[model samples]
Target chain A: SAVISQKPSRDICQRGTSLTIQCQVDSQVTMMFWYRQQPGQSLTLIATANQGSEATYESGFVIDKFPISRPNLTFSTLTVSNMSPEDSSIYLCSVVLPKSGQGGLGGYTFGSGTRLTVV
Target chain B: GIQVEQSPPDLILQEGANSTLRCNFSDSVNNLQWFHQNPWGQLINLFYIPSGTKQNGRLSATTVATERYSLLYISSSQTTDSGVYFCAVLINAGNNRKLIWGLGTSLAVNP
Candidate 1:
């Protein structure tokens, strides 16, 4: 299992302002992903951050709106650029654990999440 | 893209009662995971059962990969177990492990 942590557990920001959330893992991970959960909704994948490369975003998401940066294997950041009321959601970071090559398969560990409230 | 469907979108159970949640996938998937969102809005992973069955204390999960379905069993539910349960799956191939999430099952355990 991997231990994940995120900065700014909860923040209240005004509309049109941007906030950068940081995710740090206890150990190195191959892939880091950003997700969003709307009010009373399930999680939706935003992008996959790869170290030394550009992030791959999912449909309905773009780099301009949500810029991601992965400077190393254990750290990444997600910036909600040009925020709006619609962008007020819980953002979480997750990492895939490495397999032990035995009967056990790898799982995902998610951060505590950064809850952003846009007013 | 894979479609995930969870049954009984809302459930209210008494503490100490048992409950079962189900997840159905549209296509073959290489990965299946269950997550619980607490009232504080933290997504806590429950299990990663792509196949077979595994139990952890009062929680157990079973995934029939070939049938494209999974089941999560909660025995002797507690007030702390009241939250939303989500099931996600990775479909197509292994190139991208992008998870498609279900709307989730909201379980409320009343004392």
Candidate 2:
């Protein structure tokens, strides 16, 4: 299993400020993603962080509000810009670990998640 | 786009009891996985059953890809099992791949 180390486990930020969450994977992975879990809700995909290229954002999500940077196969960061109280949620970084003896598609592993509270 | 649906929006059980959680997908999937989100917000992978059955300890999962549904069984539940159980499916669209998720079943195992 690939382990992901996420920083700033939880934070309290004022409205309109920006926060960047980071994730470092223990091994190189081809697929890395960012997800948001709103209070008492299901996880929603934010974007796919492509190494050396711009991220692919999901519908209802944009690059302006959520900028992602994947410098390499094992590192990525997600920035929440101009945060608001409604933006308060748990942001998680996930990576897909290729199955053994298979060709690069497997279960997804997630970071511990960053709980952001905007006031 | 694929839709994932989980049944029994919520569940409550006493310790030592057993329960079953289900997941249904609208389209074909390349992979299917079950995850448990602990209270601390860590997603622990429970099973990766695209099809057939697999068991680990008291937890087991069965997926019938042909039927487009999966089931997760937990026996002799413990308080530690109390949390949200999510089912996600991986689907490929042309050159892109995405994992669609279910709303999840909120389970509470009481002591």
After aligning candidate 1 to the native by TM-score, how far in Å is the CA of A66 from where it should be?
0.8
Show model 1 residue runs off by greater than 4 Å.
Answer: A101-105, B92-94
DockQ of 2: 0.72
TM-score against native, each model = 0.95, 0.96
- Model 2 TM-score is 0.96
After aligning candidate 2 to the native by TM-score, how far in Å is the CA of B60 from where it should be?
A: 0.3
Candidate 1 residue pairs in backbone clash? none
How do the candidates score on chain B by TM-score? 0.95, 0.97
lDDT of 2: 0.92
Model 2: residues with Cα > 4 Å off, grouped in runs: A101-105
lDDT of 2 by residue, B51-107 (tens): 999888999999999999999999999999999999999899557777889999999
* Residue B29 miss distance in model 1 (angstroms): 0.4
How far does residue A51 in candidate 2 sit from its true spot (Å)? Answer: 0.9
Worst 10 residues of 1 chain B by lDDT: B90-99
Taken over the whole model, the C-alpha lDDT of each candidate is 0.91, 0.92
Using DockQ as the measure, the top candidate is 2
TM-score, model 2, chain B versus true chain B: 0.97
